[model samples]
Target: MNKRLLKLAVTSALTVAFAVPAFANPFSDVPAKHWAYDAVNKLAQAGVVTGYEDGTFKGDKTVSRYEMASIVAAAMQKDLNSDQKETVDQLSKEFATELNSMGIKVEAIDKKVDNMVKISGDARVRYGASDSYDNTDFRARVSFDGKINDNLKFNARLTSDNMNYDDEFATKTGIKLDTANVSFDALGLTNTVGRQDLVLGNGFLHDSAMTGIASEIGNLKLFAGHLKDSNEVYGAEYGMKLGAADITADYVKYDTATNDVDVYGANVGIKLTNSVTALGEFYNVDQGNTDANAAAYGLKFNKLGLTALYRDVEDGANSAYSGMHNDIQTLKDEDGYKGLEVRYDRALAKNTTLNLKYQDFEKQDGTEIDGGARTQAAINVKF
Candidate 1:
């Protein structure tokens, strides 16, 4: 076909595919009286076409396969009806080779859609009993993640926990915002600010949510935040890999009214075999006049989905924000505790899991506290 005929054919196809009114003309060469003016204007507004750098449509000139492929690729990114999508799909196949040579895949273009926000959540039913107490509860969490741009993201979670089955549905529990934060990259560091989750040194020293800012680069992270108790905390953690072992070191300081408390921790995991790993961690806390320490050693049987650990924590060693406070509730005491814990985890199906845990603890003085032995079973599901 001649150049004019070919250009007319292309313009007609785009006009039929995107039948929208044009607000303004972007190409100087296409006057309002021109035959293809509306079609060219609509294509420009939809990002389906960009004329030459000189700002002229030059519709009399023939369009190359590469140029047509670029237009098809851009159309694939738009929200279209069934008929429009089918038209674009046919065009994509016709120009697949040109699109691929230009570093764009027709299949990838077809999959492109506006998926800026995602919603996910998990629910759990748990039962636990100890020497002094037994209870059953349910917990649910919903999370929202939004991509604002290539460099910025926002995340939030709503959670309700410890809902008694016997209570009225509406009165069982109240939902609360557990986390809200935005993360971005700047100045060679990835930074997160707001209420966010934080874990340090294999969770031996701290594991909880904090309100403030955290920055990370490479294998090092720096954070300054406050716990639920309103005490400000500052910390840094560095991790490195050496041969078959991974090591992490961290330091945290709590800024309180009475005094500044410091904590130091080191954690290591060594691969012992294909299905077994050895883990160790040590933590020391300094509270001015008093000093305390905690240590743990464990073995992880990866293939069997089991873990066994022994932990010793002095009366003042454990952090109030430790995640263990929730997992091993019987061990929470001002007098400190030492314990042996065993856990078995297995996936029953996709996005579903079963967990069984048992712990035995005694006070530092070798006396058993009430509810010192505890066991729990939980089923968790995620979507």
Candidate 2:
């Protein structure tokens, strides 16, 4: 057979064998009523053939042996039944020279296209009862990661505000863009700019969202940003490994209208044994009128999947205007609360977990807030 007729015959056979669902015709030249239209469109959708840069399927044009080999290589990557596999094997054998010259080029292109973008997300359903309220709520977040180039990347996440099923499930709709950032490497530093989450020194000092720029070199990171409430924040953190322990130091300055607040702290984690780890953090806040400190020490039993922490936060110790660790529920209502929190986590299934937590907290000045106790259970899932 002639080259063009041969190409048409091979494509027609493959199209009938593969039998993929029809897609919207992508090439203007291949009209619905044309004899080769269905075959061409199916082959294109299967990645067995790509017509031209201008998106035209020139069926009358002859295809070279190398081009036909590329088509066979692509068909080899598809999921095929026995008969289809035998036909592809025969074609591959006929074009062995071209396929061998191509080497890993086809595989590289396939991987690049597959890894160009990724989507991931997680959701949580939580039930909690405290002295003040008992409720059930749900929260979810979806994230997208895109590669701009070898050295640059883009990421964004959409988050839903906690929807309380106990109260306004039907009327509450609170979905928003929570994080959007682009990161790249330049000037011997890794840089990120945009709205992103910031967590400093075990979250004893700050764990919130900020919009600005951050740069990291080795174990050190520097950032300058503003909070949702318009409070300007600048911080630095350096982490190092000493002996068998990991230590991190943090410094953050918050620029408020009335005064500038400084929060500095250090966190250390040591593996006491193969199954036990010790964690501690100490933070000192220097506000214009209020100067206080916060400290937390915890023990994690890795084998048991349990963690216990004790927190003693003085009033005004947390300089961040928003965001706090949920381990101590009282921190949401009263800042100067001292508490002991214990949590146990168990794997329910792949990418799913069951978590139970209990906290007992009282005001630092010996007063009770939110009944001074809380219990919570949550099921977390990721996909």
Model 1 misplaced stretches (Cα beyond 4 Å): 1-111, 166-169, 328-330
Error of 2 at 220 (Å): 0.3
| Candidate 2 least-lDDT 10 residues | 18-27
Q: Whose TM-score is greatest here?
A: 1
Question: Model 2, stretches more than 4 Å misplaced?
Answer: 1-111, 319-330
RMSD of each: 20.9, 19.8
lDDT of each: 0.73, 0.71
Model 2, position 3, has a per-residue lDDT of 40
Task: Give the distance in Å from residue 62's predicted Cα in candidate 2 to where it truly belongs.
Answer: 54
Candidate 2 C-alpha lDDT tens digits along 192-282: 9999989887666788889999999999999999888898999899998887688999988989888998888999989786467799989
- Per residue, candidate 1 scores C-alpha lDDT tens digits across 207-293 of 888999999999999999888889999999999888878899999999998899999999998878646779999989999988999
